[model samples]
Target: MRALIRFLFLLAVVAALVLAGAYYFAGRAAGPQIEIHRPTRLLGRTGTLDVSIQAPGGRFNDVTVALTQQGRTVPILQLLNPDAGGAPPDPRTKLTQETGDRIRVTHPLDRQTLPGLREGAAVITVTAGRPVLFGLRTTASSADRRVEVRLTPPKVSILSTHHYINHGGSEMVVYRVDPPGAESGVRVGQLQYPGYPATGAGVQADPTVKVAFFALLYDQDLNTPIELFARDEAGNQSRASFDYRVFPKAFRKSRIDVDTRFMERVIPEIADHTPELSVSTASADELLKAYLVVNGDLRRKNAAFIREQARTTVPEILWAGAFAQLGNSQVESGFADYRTYYFDGREIDRQVHLGFDLAVTANVPIVAANAGRVVFADYLGIYGNSVIIDHGMGVQSLYGHLSSIGVKPQQNVANGREIGKSGMTGLAGGDHLHFTMLVDGQMVSPVEWWDPHWIEDRVLRKLREARSRPS
Candidate 1:
């Protein structure tokens, strides 16, 4: 009985030894275990944030990284073929092939990252594992890592001290940027006043980052305040305020007198020819409205004609400033009745001269300031022998009190081309040309358009700069 028991005990000991050896060999073949060297961490916002993972002993097929913000998992990185599963000498779980080794991953936080993800603190978790038993098994979990993201937006500041104010049209507001960066991504908020036109925002390297804003003033009320706002990529914001005070402007009445000889002659001839003579006395305001209506009608009628003719020729009309006549002139009292006529007279009595008198010798050649089509070259109510030209884009020029009309309706004329001769027509006092400019039906100061330098610096320059800016 004792011998038999010893044999059985010896057999049991051999079996135990074999099992222990097998377990040892299996663990060795599996290779060294891999652990996350550093837990995934959050980085501040508004800039690049780099995260890295380290695998010790290189015993992982791949590394899985996840970012969590406010308990929500964020997809930071995705690994392909993360687990290497193969037959095992000592079970698949225990034995890892040479293919399954160290695994490392990296995640970068950029502008494209989730919005709230960059706002506050976030958690990063990294897991290292390999394929075992036809499934992925985590070998080690990284320690919890936390990161803070900050929101930093761009900044905007106006370089000028005071806001620019003008009569009523397009205006540019220039601003300077502190740190030059990506300007295309910036957004500008609307102004307080709704009447202001859309603003043209852009950046420049030479003069400075400029935002050319266009605003309109319908009413002449002063002390109007306008607000502007800007925001950057990181959610940063800036604001500015400007006020415009509409001051009273003085109205200057031209002291020069108009000679009525030309008008006197034309009216009698027109009466003799046409049985019905249309005679109307128009004030400055009424005359402007009439000019617009007539000009528009003429443009519509001669659209094709103007386009075909002016396409090849430059404008011939030239704009001259208000001038006074050196020779003797006579003025009629009023439109009511030809009661009194004054020669070389300066009277603040009977009739008030509303416009500046342009004195030119009779039969002197008159030209256009720009290329355009003649819309009207007939007798106007009180304008007498008049010619109106359409210059496109809601701009029109008028020449009244002409001795003779050279260009007929629908005729194209080039700049500096003779359209008529200076004469005292309509309700004029002398033989001189009357020139006027209208914008969108409203009469603007002709003096401004006459200055080429002003147009280049203010109008053309802004347009060129706006076109060059990136959309």
Candidate 2:
């Protein structure tokens, strides 16, 4: 019995030795290893920084990282239980065979955390570890990473006209440049335009390039010294300054000679289509009376309508120069003959001249000044075969005494498209095209619609730039 017991004890000791050797080798294999990659050593103080790290085989927890500049450490980030409200205390920083393990961590530097560390070299340190696992203590590890932050001059340029008066409203200026290559992988911070209302500045990507920038506007008067600034990924900044002067907004005025007789003839037709009048007459005297009595009212009503139809939103194509001609001197004798009369320019002794006279030659194609739906395309009164297009917004265009009508009523016509041929159709004297523009049934100057630059600078640009200055 004593000999059997001795053999069993020897076997037990051998088994214990094999198990201890296996554990020792495993612990050695799990030695703590850490790697830190500082891809971009030079960073813009206000821009973004990207850091990468690699740790083998161990889970990283409670990692606290900071950027150090001039002996002061600025906490970049701390990885902790998000539920804990704050980062946990650092673990012991010793590596041992029994507790050695591997871990990895990465961090992104942005504007908020790198405020004071601009224009200097920065050191990044990471502390990582976890609590005891199965009653075995583990050692925490740290790695030192270095990066250089530099301040770069900004690129600033004037987006608006080089010279502008204090119009006292928002003026848009676009400033842009290519973003840092590192920012290509992620969304960069919002671009802000200083010295302007917060709502007025916004960041947008350039349509033609990978660069992004802010479109900022100065909505208030530049009475004081104004500075323009831009910021980049590493928080680098650039700025420029310009002086502003208060000057009267520029405007131009010119007088256009209008033939009142020609205007009077078309007044009745325009008024007949107006919704406000509700009643109209074919008599020339009666029409003239309505025009004189309600001329102001008609202008107000029609101005609203005509402005709506004006091609003021964008630029318009204009016909250059004016073609002058004479028309028939007598009215058409028959209803089928398309007879119309021209009254003399004077209000008194309005003599009837035979035929409608246009300023263009016979068969000259007439173009519609604006886009609209055609409402009339037939012969009536003294107008031979006439065409009327109702361009919505209370404006209408009439091409009268035409030799031929290319469009029918209810047909859609685009701006500057040929709609009819000019002719002396109604009365018999000479051949010319009678063109007219009507607003709310009253004839204003047709010259305004034919001038592209005038409409843009005067009507469109001025309105867009106007500041609500109290009179």
Candidate 3:
């Protein structure tokens, strides 16, 4: 009996050692690990889910993703069998993959498809299981996410009238927004021009009312809808159209002849300063091609750079009344002139002259069109020695081809202040000043801003009404 008892004790000790070795190698105590990556808060009606799993020393046997609401289980996806489990229709958005013992899946959620998203509180559960080496399969789950979705859009309305805008001119609109947090703006084409808090200068200072100066680009389609748009954080959008009249004007066209002397002088001057063209050492033919490329390709890049500077502006009104032009200067060219360039009796290129060219001899004083801060004062590609002034609220003026700049960037200059001197620095045939009026960086006819009568009837009259109205 003593020998038998000793033999049983030895057998029990051997069994305990084998079990400990198997568990240590397989990591059965930890079980499968699951990690869920989700946003801390969901302000929008739609969101997404990105899940990652780490199964050590085991292969994933079952994986399920589901949305639970009102005791209803809507299965989002399952990865049971590679052949039996079909993927979402769009693999880029919803996908499941496994590499070794790890698995990952990403899915996008929309309120329209996922009805549970409309519920006030919905739970998203992810459960995963793995098969271990010792038949110690374990399951892990995470149901910690309870989402809140909003779907109501904000309201916007126009308060002021006489919304007449010329084809290549600027106009101001006064509007009101219900929720101050919503982003309200003017939507024209793909671009949205945001509105600002109204000032007591033009429109009465109201917390809800917003003032926005918008432009109708010369090349914009007449049938395009220009409406006030508002959107909330929940992805809800709203639009309201105001009564307005657009007067379309036919722009003047001109043909410019590019001769040997014109090419010889402009090319050498440009090539000497601009090495980006790589045409300083080229022949006459190559120089002409380079000029065409500069006029076409480089022109767009210069305009884009100028437009990007309009993003930051003072909210207050910096200037009032009609803008002042360069005194004793004659208008040499008009705005929006469709020009055709001819070289050696053949048409080489075509471009639109956006601003007016004022001639006042060589190196004449150029004054600030209105009171504003200088945004940019440097050499540009086509408009060399350029200076741009911001007159607040998306209204700005640009002076190009200057002989010398007098003001630095961010310097405040009043109306009629000398900012620079004009010269034939850029792509020009003679000494002239390129003056342009930009509304939100879109080139508009400066003739409107130069006429005092137009300002009183269209712009100042609207301001007078706003001032007289009970605040």
Candidate 4:
């Protein structure tokens, strides 16, 4: 009886050991997790494929990625354990990073990288595995993504001629893009001015025809390269050079004297209104420091805000005639005036005055420069109590230093309509109106828009000529 009992106990112990071994080797049924972040829907002619892999306890041993199309497989990346001796990896496979338990891979999917690649539906397969069952077997996971390949670039060409742009002025370009929905524009050096449909500009032309109002900003070099560019959704791009000329112009330079009283009035008010500047207004020295910050940093912020407002303009032309200048007003400061600031007979700072400062009388009524919708009506930094009106097609007018605004945002006003009352609410020495014209967010010479002949020759004639031509 004792021998029989001993045999039963040993048999039970052996059975438990076998079960424990099996559980330790094949406990986890799930494979490594694979993630492909790029090439989700469409694959352009040239793009990067980003992939990540994670294993149980970060213990990946093998990973493979490939692109499959039309019964052909192109290997992108493959990583295997050196101990698991196999054939060498393909020369094209590039492994970016490999940690103890995770792996990252990045490969370029381009014509030069992958030859014989055609435009069609393709599948990217990512497989990852980790050692299981004591290195005898592998637990693997896979993910497949289907994407469409696009290789052809969008076509772009100029449709209108006589594209003359002044160094500090604005010009309009009429062009055509093969794909109407493609984003087309005028590229002046690094600055991009977006194009709108010609129909919106009152031109009964083809849908693919676009009109863009671009500028040769005052700061840009006189010989900056200008060209028309078009880009499609798949990242395909093309450019075309048009016949254009750049005329050089000279700007005025002047000196501005700052007084203690002006600092106390302007600096304190601007600092109080602009808390983001984080400037101290407790003492005279601090007030001077705050003044510098407002004039430089706050001024740039205000200009960026105005540019953002220009983005929401309507596509069609809203104004009918030349922009109207303030009546019975004297131009105190001209556009692009390089002003040097002096306090106590010492040079303090210098900045370019972008707008024309006009003064008629204290608290004079300010009117709309043209027929357009008021896009912004509020207190802007440095400009103080300003209003910006959109005249459509990337053209806008700004009226600053207003004591009170009568029109609200989105309110349409006719030409010469009174919109506000001018005052010294902002950084103004006396009650006046700061007016300027913006072309595609660039502050250009408003003098061009104010002249009827310049408008007739530069803008109106281009539209009429483009409309006369067929698609």
Candidate 5:
């Protein structure tokens, strides 16, 4: 009887050990994990749903993903495989996968896929299986998340009808958009001119409506399409087109001769500032290269910085009439001039001069061209000592290569107020001011801004007309 009892006890202990081992392997097995990337918060009516699927050790035998909103379950994708999708065997499906580690899922989500999905939270559940019972069975789902869906787009309309856009100048547009919090702007090519809350002048800026001053640089294609765009938090987008009157004009072209003195002064300055020039000991060829770098590479970077500074502007009309020009000054160079540099009688480089070069007495007073809040008053590369004044509604003026600056950032200056003095500090052949007018950071013709007639007929007339209309 005792021997039989010992035999029974040993058999029971062995059975328990087998069960413990099976449980241990099952514990290591993990369910599918989902990382939702897109529709981050509010899903758009017509947008994409991006997610990443991951399995720790083995592949999933079965995978299922579904979206549940208002008691409705919409299936996204399902795959039945023994190997938790270590390597993807199929294309067309975006499942970022590395053999045996993780997988991803990125699919389009819109009204077509998720019927009746409205502006609210929706639950996303993912279930994945990994063989744990000696490669015999799989585990259950381990991921569940929520996504916000927004299917409605913001309403937008143009208030200013008459828009005068010089082929390479700036203009202002006043428009209204519903849902005061929605983002609205004008899109030209890849660049977007943002909308700001209008303020200043006698006119009150409405929260839903704003006036944006934007630019048309000479570099941009004259025929490039433009549109006014608005979008809400839900990624719903709307667009509107306005009647635009384009004025075309020819730009000046000139060949500038490079002198020895000019090269020596500019090249050393370039090498001192730009580490990429790679000319510890300046040679003729290296000096030319440095000059090109400063003209081409550095020029573009400085322009981008200026654009960033001009992005934030007041909404109200600041200036009263035409912008002021420097007194007793002569036009040394014209705006939108196509310039070619000749070195040793050979054409070395070419660039488009975006600003008018005004020759004035050395260290003469540099005044504000119009009444505006000083947005940027600092040293800018290539332009040297520069000051940018924001004339509200995305309209701004750039005064470059100044000898001295008398104003600080955020300070308000009236038209003809002395802000600085002219100088030959940056890439300038002589003491002069590089004056340019910009709309949304795009260079435009300054001639129109200087003419009171143009302001009344092209810009202010439309604003007056818009305000006179019934609410």
Candidate 6:
């Protein structure tokens, strides 16, 4: 009986040892991990692949990457048999060794790199192999990503001609874009003015036709090239140029003398309205300092805020005929007036006043310049009680320095409708209405837009011709 018991105990110990050995081998057989960082969905004409690989023992035997489409596979990268001193098979594949167990690989996936590539569904596969069990066995891991290859650019064409834009003024263009829903716009140097469907402008001619309102600000050069561009979701872009003329004008420069009472009135009010600015309106010196901050920093912030608000404009023409100016008001300041500010016999700062300052009777009722929706009706930094109306197609009008606002945001109003009452609010010296025309968030001269003949010739003529012509 004792001999038989010893035999059974030995058999049990052998079985435990075999189980431990199998577990150890199975753990060692696990492969390396892979991570792909870019081109998560669509691969364009010039796309890149970023991949990372990690191995358990700080070393990988081989790594290979290939793209498969329509049942065909094309190798893009290969790091083969590093222990055998084998280099990468493709010269364009960039390989980096982060550590013994980790590596990074990047390669271009463009058509020039992969000549066999076509616009269709594709799969990117990355496989990594690491040696285990004393180099006798190879453990492997793979990662695959599905993406669409897009090679064709969107088609853009100009449908209107005889475009004339005044320096520091606004203009409109009508164009057509294939793939109707693609993002199409007018690109002027570094600035982009978005396009709206022509149907939005009440034109029932073509669904693909688009209209855009653009501007040449007081700062941009007259010769700055402007072109219409169409870009698809896959980052493919196409641009076309149309004939346009630019007329330059001389801007007037003036000096603004700052006084103690003006600072005392304006600084404290702006500071009270704007909690974002940290300033003590107690002393004259501090008031002057705060005034500078409001003029320079707060002014820039307000401009940026207006630009952001412009993004919410409806993609249609809400205004008909020319925009209107304040009734019986005299222009106290013209658009783009280069003003040099002075305090205590010394120049403090210089800034360009982009809007017209019109003055009538104190606390006079302010009216909307055109038919549109009110985007903002509140106390805006320097503008005080202000109202911004979206005239659509990226064109808007501003009625600033109001004592009271009568309209609410998103409320539609007709031309010459009362929006507020003018007062000495914001940075104003006296009761006035600061009026301007905004083209795609850019402040432009409202003179042209206020003229009946200019509106008919520059804007309405193009829309009429586009609707009358065959698509």
> Which candidate wins on TM-score?
4
Clashes of each: 30, 27, 0, 1, 11, 2
TM-score of each: 0.36, 0.31, 0.81, 0.89, 0.87, 0.85
**Model number with the top lDDT:** 6
- Over 99-182, each residue of candidate 4 has an lDDT whose tens digit, in order, gives 665656677778876678889999999888888876766778899999888888889998888888887899998899989898
Model 1 spans with C-alpha error above 4 angstroms: 1-248, 254-356
- Estimate, for each residue in 1-471, the C-alpha lDDT of model 6 and write its tens digit: 999999999999999898779657855676989999867998877788899898864577888888999999998777886445466677777778777777788888787767788899999999989887666667889999999999898899998878998999988899999888779989998999999999898778767899999998899998898999998877778999999999998899999999889999998898899998999978888888998999899999999998888887999899999889898999989999999999998999999998999999999989988899999999998998899999998899988899999999999999989998999889999999999899988899999999999999988999998989886
Model 3 CA lDDT for position 254 = 91
Superposition TM-score, candidate 5 onto the true structure: 0.87
When sorted by lDDT, best at the front, the candidate numbers are 6, 4, 5, 3, 1, 2
Q: Please give the ranking of all candidate structures by TM-score, highest first, separated by commas.
A: 4, 5, 6, 3, 1, 2
Model 6 stretches astray by more than 4 angstroms: 1-40, 48-65, 75-108, 126-141
Writing each residue's lDDT as its tens digit, candidate 1 over 335-444 gives 11212232247332232222234564676877876767777787654455777776643345677778888898778777777888878765455677666554433333
- What shift in Å separates residue 254 of candidate 6 from its native position after superposition? 1.0
C-alpha lDDT (0 to 100) for residue 244 of candidate 2 = 33
Task: Single out the weakest 10-residue window by summed lDDT for candidate 1.
Answer: 193-202
Candidate 4 error regions (>4 Å): 1-28, 52-59, 79-105, 130-138
Estimate the Cα RMSD of every predicted model relative to the unseen true structure: 22.5, 20.8, 5.1, 3.9, 3.5, 4.9
What's the lDDT for residue 270 in model 2?
50
lDDT of 2 by residue, 68-169 (tens): 888998886666532233333333222222222332333445566566766667777766544334324434667776777766654653333233332221
| Reference-based lDDT, residue 432, model 3 | 93
Error of 6 at 81 (Å): 14
